[model samples]
Target: MTETTKQPIRVALVDDYDVVLTGLAHMFDRYRDRIVICEIDANAELSDQVDIVLYDSFAQPESDRQELAALVRNPRASRVVVYTWNFQPELVESARTQGTHGYLSKTLPARELVAALEAVHAGERVVSEPPSKRVGSAPGLDWPGRHEGFTERESEILALITQGKSNAEVAALTYLSVNTIKSYIREIYRRIGAASRTQAVLWGVAHGFSPDHHRIDHWLGGP
Candidate 1:
């Protein structure tokens, strides 16, 4: 929702890569009225007042966790969206479980990233549905041809994980309990043998399945 010259949402970007930060800055520049983007490439001091935190996994692992913990501690966070370059399902899952706002790919299109920010700000979980498979583990695991084993709902969850959507978001979108979504996703991993998000996305791509927002809307049944 764009307003004509409205005040921007205060935002912070924490990442180790300058290129990623710059790209994000440029993206937000267009939404300058919607996102202020106060801090770029920050290592710490994730404020409570900001609308959201666009953080990198490598830049501040512990610190990022601490920031998340703090946000939940108050139970009144503005919002926190992670823009991760190195994908890991466990880490992303952990962040989702920990109450971070959303997760997205660092390499995702600026439009997608912006959409994620707006979604998170609106308090919606925004993740891209990648694909579904038998599920596998290890960063090195090669994808199999049969991802058809995962259920329609389970596949929907996997797609979100691949796109960096939080479990909470899955719950809302699917109208399932947070714990239920978590359980399904864990099962997807076990079935696919994937230990992380990057591997999952790669596997989804290798397999015939590809995540699309429409897939979730069309298949991940909800009210």
Candidate 2:
């Protein structure tokens, strides 16, 4: 398709890790003629910045429903899509309810990824079928936190920390105080044998602690 006739979809990537962002940038580089990545950001808000915001959840199993809702509710963002590995049935439905235009698996090749983005830009709600089974054991590995005696609260904190949130940001998102967030991080580090945030993030990524099993009420404080 001619560049004039086929306009590349403008995409903005949202991921906490620099590596993910950089990798995605390179992956999509070949499709520059079809898709243009306008920006890469960790912040949740972008006022009409681009045609689509792709939220990557490689390390995050639980889709942050609140963040998805906010992006959909904002008139500025034209479209929002969750690029994730977590396709729990309920999570997919919850994301749709919150205005996500698409839910795609990370396993999709770059060409399919581009097609999905194009479909979303065309105003379709796209949810790719999950693989009949997880490709390999590598994707489903979970940290033995429960067996390690970690509490539900600790699990939630670890999830957010892995997503690269600061103590203040985690406190704001979870409706807890900064000091409380710090204390939880300390205890989590001690239990998990992590000496720093980087170590904790790496552990979380490895063991799938990035996706906490949180009810909406747990983070949103609803009845």
Q: Tell me the tens digit of each residue's lDDT in model 2 across 1-223.
A: 6565777777777765444455666667667877877666644346335788888764344457767777787776799899765567877888888878898887787878888899999989899877554442122222235456765457657878877888897876555689999999999999879898999999988865553322111111111
| TM-score of every model versus the real structure | 0.47, 0.61
Off by over 4 Å in 2: 1-4, 136-223
Residue pairs with clashing backbones, model 2: 61-211
lDDT of 1 by residue, 4-24 (tens): 665556666655334334445
In order, how many clashes per candidate? 18, 1
lDDT of 1: 0.55
Which portions of model 1 show Cα errors greater than 4 Å?
A: 1-6, 16-23, 59-64, 71-77, 130-223
| Local lDDT at 164 for model 2 | 85
Task: Give the Cα lDDT of each candidate.
Answer: 0.55, 0.68
